[model samples]
Target: MKRQQPAQIKGLKKWLDPVYSAWTSIATHKLRSSLTILGIVIGIAAVIALMSIGRGAQAQILSRIQGLGADLLGIRPGMTMAGGIRGGFGSASTLTLEDAEAIKEQVPYIAALAPTFSSYQQLVAGNQNMNAQVIGTAPEYMFLYNLEIADGDFFTDYDYQRGSRVAVLGANVKQTLFGDEPPVGQQMRIGGNIVRVVGVLKAKGAVWASPDDAVIIPLTAMQQMVTQPRTSRGERVVTSIALKVTDQNQIEFVTQQITDLLRSRHRLAPGADNDFNITSVQSTVEALKEATGTMTLFLSAVAAISLLVGGIGVMNIMLVSVLERTREIGILKALGARERDIWGQFLTESAFLTLTGGIIGVVVGCGVSVLLSRFKVMTTLLSADIIVLAVVVSLGVGLFFGFYPAWNASRLDPIEALRYE
Candidate 1:
């Protein structure tokens, strides 16, 4: 007669018997199991929380930059470099209002462009006096920057043509000068020149550039009343030109055209570099992505170290478990349990421990993320992919660390294991 098979077990219920037994064994030593799982829980939670914070920072930065305008380009003065290093600051007179007018006349893709001139001046309102940066720009500045009026209206073409002493109050400037009182129609002294506040801009919130910190006035008024007297060279000048492109896709083309035109006008040779720097949304986005990528990598590495420690803890605990269960292992072996069955039982126990910790970790990480979002600190976008990945990694840690102990237990001789004290 053939040797009787060990009771012909079948179906999922039969396969789960060993798993159930392993779980019971772990439950008997509740404190030890909970402590072992706590390490994994903390580690996985750290990984998820840190990664979410990094991603949130990236999103916030990108949103702020894009909020300025996707189709805008900024031109500032810079040196022409011959070799690897920069020579020095380029000519101060490189960019001019004439160039801005030429671009408005020549480039069809250019929707609007404004020449900006600025200075820090003491602004006086009744008995209130505060020093703030004053920006000089044409009426078109409002449209180019998407600045909206909270009260009254922006200065018009007639104001620019007449060179009127009209000003627009930035959000913070209004608060400083008038508090809760309406600033529209109020006359304020800027550099001893009285200018009427025709418009008060709505609060734009604090942005990276902080536009709310400056006071805006007609370009002509600023050039004549504020800037010309201070210029030793006696040249009425503007600092930089901000341009709004008709289409985002045409930014590169328009930027190149503007560069070539400005270079030619500035008497730069074909081989010589231009005297102005052009900043576009695309360039800003690329730089931000690179910086954020570096930060993510660094944070991930730090979190990975925690995960490694958790893995080691699991391995150590599993080894101790094997030694503690030596008699139990021998009893099963003596009852004719196969080596594979012993391995399966231990592996299941280890996986269940880690899986439990991982589930709890995901919940805690997401809870923290939600709290952060509520406080307007950052966003935590916990997608299905990340959740699945966390689970897989947790299970992988259990399997990887549990293998050695499981194998060692499985290889024990039945007679020796039976005699183990």
Candidate 2:
């Protein structure tokens, strides 16, 4: 037991000796050590801050997409080609109210469906007038679009069935038309018809075709105002159809089933191109996530360039340190210090410098992120993994850059070092 105790004590001393020597050397040249640490600090801080911004942007995109309802699927009429000039999606009136009804009856796993017609129209409330996207849809549209009433009640099925001229206002539209005052019970004019405001929707943030800049009315009422397109069988034409799935897991399956059913209903020949376009909110979210993830990785890589610069500074300083301590290394060797001891000490000094800087940089970076979010400049998301990455990266840079200097110091000749001035 006594023999083993001596060996353990020696091992402990060997490990701690290098750390103590490194600290002493750093303290002796505080200014130089600080300058070396400052480079690492800036590098690590830049990495953390830029990564935080990238992550925040990714989160914002995800939030906005999820806000659109994960189980939602949007179907729009496909393009029309005339004289070889192809029009954009929704230009052709290939879909009808009967198609929507057929899907509601045939397709399984459907929670709710909304067939809609939309057009740009001038809305006038008192003397306030502005051009806004006007949507004509049923009450089910509220569920499919994930809309919430901020002020008043949405129109009911009774209002829809009777084609009552009731309207719902989006947050931006309400703000522009009525400001802070309640807009419910107010009357607005659309085209030549007068409509009563029934509700106001909450702000959903800006996205492609933002609902915040739209006004909603019953589908039947919209047909009366606009020049309604009709099928050969006299079925009313619709611009788009939005449906929600009962189970989020069944979204892909339901989407395929909808495609097949729509193709069959439209009587398109086999292998022919579809006259409709379908978009899955879940799939869209995944695509956006992939794009954002790539962007975040790119931003992180750009920020890491500073870390390379810092590492070069560390290598420069370490080489200078080795040159200045050549005589000291020789004296230690003459006093019976081993080569490994010198190597360990210099490497420990380099690692300690970077590790300290890494910690300080983390604190500074977190402070910057908080300030950005608080001031509404940008949103930031910091995770435990990021801090761990910073520590590991900083330590890695030190070890890699400090190697040559540590080796050079360790290889000095004891006789030559002892004779140095």
Candidate 3:
């Protein structure tokens, strides 16, 4: 066994020698190698950065929607058709307080309801004046939006009954109208009517039309001040109604019940188009997630085109390397080096080039992600899977494009190669 140790050592040296030589060849041509890897670095970095932003946006959207309560559902007036033109959501005031009341009274699966009316109006608080979204909703508006009173109290049911000119300020509204001073108890003029401030809401951050930038008042007061439509049933017209389900599992059942109830109330015949639409938190979230996922995939595909180009660049450089080292390959074959050894050496060089560039690209992408978020440009999320993908893709590119050049070197006729050189 001791005598055979020398042969084993020789075999190991033979295997390692080619890898070491490949490393040496790449190191000696630092400038050429660097330039060749630049395309790959750029491609991989772009893919990661764009994907990180997509992932972060998706998470934020899901979190915001989830925070609104999974059991929550929103009911808005259906599309309005006037002549040939089609109006968008809430264009017609078909929903009324009577509808909200009926749902609350008849729907056993419902936990709560907040009938709401909204319009954009200019608000004046002493010297500060700004245009803001004014919402007329029930006292449960804060609960529906997951908002808390930072100071004072929300307007009471008695205030709504009397159509009192009282209001609750959103975080942004408070900051804009009151500055550093207390907003509660201060009077603000909205739609030319002076409404007393009853409370200020806690910061909930900004999402799609977030309540953080809105002003809340009683539904009755809103109709009285904002000129909302009045129904023949002597009930106030509302733009939408928010409902809370007793159980998340009962969402579909409750939705069908609501549809039946509303269609009957609207006097629509069987199979007739309804005048209202009910949207659930879960369905909305799933739709948004699907859209975001598709967008991310499309953008990532665009970015990957650059990697394809980079692979072509790798092939070009490897071919050049083979030509430049023709005599070296010939000398190795003359010294009894096998064709497999030649192939392994060339393949190793190509792999080393990609692996190094891939590592650098990852660092670059992460740095760009950090910078974008630091400047508040946009959000970015980097996951372990993304990093692994970049490395694996780079290695795959090396193997795919490097094969032809490596094979060409391995198949060279040593006598012809030496004679030509």
Candidate 4:
């Protein structure tokens, strides 16, 4: 005669009652619940922070390497063995200005080339003197190295041909010598030899090599004033050559052609080792990428250990929780609650605890990452995928570790649990 609620509806309400009570009970023991969640929070935070740093570092490295120019190729003097002994393993003096000219004339795919020699010397401007690297290079070196002229202009072919003692200051060198004042047309002493400052380079942030710590001068001036001429031994000479290729795809072909040409010119016998090394920008980039990946994996592994520890902590706490709430389980069983309902209730409580901790950990981790990036300690990129993964992992931990305790509680004898005190 009277309207009756469906049995399923009544059962659903009864099932949810234990979950609600468990949450409230946990709230009553705030300190214990907080302590239990601390491990998970720290673990998640560590994972997030470490992953972000790794990604940021990789990005920074790749960007710097790419900035060197995609078409760049570097040639360095290679080791050579002679008379059954290592004779000229040092830098080869055979790579002269003539080699640079030969490469340009012979290699059709080569867009530009620069032969460079470097030495460290004291640079004096008025009363200010500081030790800085002096690089002897042609004007094309600027474009090959992606250097921009901030003021004035790079040395012309006339400067190289006439052996002008003109110099260009890198951004840092300019600032250190002249401060905010214009440096062009100023006379500076490099290794006690007077040289005119013809240009100031734009500021390029520090990379694998600091671009700001050097002064650029004509290669002829470096040879005449800075480096002592070799008498008999051909060991002292230009260190490297930079080549800009016309096509990225032709890098290997160009490298092989150059090697063959140099080997022939050097008169090395067939099957004998050549005395030069050629490196490409792509190879450098690949090496950097691989190193970054290794670093990221190592850091992530270390952080994962913490997550594993957190999972074990969750399991231990859930077991303790089941033991402590034995009386509650018995009362619920006595009140006609089903075993499945008891299982769900305990499982839900564990999940809620972990999920709450995970959310908090994500926020804290992101905040820490942002702060670190702002301070230039490392870069942090928080992606949507990482956030989703953190939450999923946290929920999974709860499910995996909470199951045993939940099942044990659900299977307890009501009479025995009721008398468990």
The better candidate by TM-score, 2 or 4, is 2
* Ordered list by lDDT, greatest first: 2, 3, 4, 1
CA RMSD of all predictions: 4.5, 2.9, 3.7, 4.7
Error of 2 at 149 (Å): 2.5
What lDDT tens digits, residue by residue, belong to model 2 across residues 1-421? 4555588789998888878888899888899989999999988988898889899999998887787778889999999989999999989889999999999999999999999999999989988999999999989999888788998898999989999999999999999999888899999899778999999999888585578999999998898888878977788889999999999999888888989998998899999999999988877888988999998899889879988898889989999888888899998998888999889889998998888888888888778877898899998888889889998999998899988999989999988877777
Q: How close to the true structure is residue 21 of candidate 2, measured as C-alpha lDDT?
A: 85
- Report residue 21 deviation for candidate 1 (angstroms): 5.0
Model 4, 23-117: lDDT tens digits are 89679779878876787788788878988898889888888888888899988877645565664433446666667777889987998899888
Candidate 1: worst-modelled 10 consecutive residues by lDDT: 228-237
lDDT of 1: 0.82
| lDDT for position 36 in model 1 | 82
Go through the candidates in order and give each one's C-alpha lDDT.
0.82, 0.89, 0.87, 0.84
Error of 4 at 293 (Å): 4.1
What is the Å distance of residue 115 in model 3 from its true position?
0.6
lDDT string for model 1 (1-421, tens) is 8764455544665877867887898899899899888888887887777778777788878888877788989887776455666555533556777777887887769888898888899999988889998988888888887888899999998988888999998899889889989888889999889999999888888456666878988888887776442223343446788999988889989998998788876777888766788898678888998899688678867977888888888889999999988888999999988999899888888888888888888888778877888898777555666667777888898898888889988988888888989
User: Which residue pairs clash within candidate 1?
Assistant: none
TM-score of each: 0.85, 0.89, 0.83, 0.78
Candidate 2 runs further than 4 Å off = 1-11, 82-86, 179-183, 206-209, 231-235, 332-341, 411-419
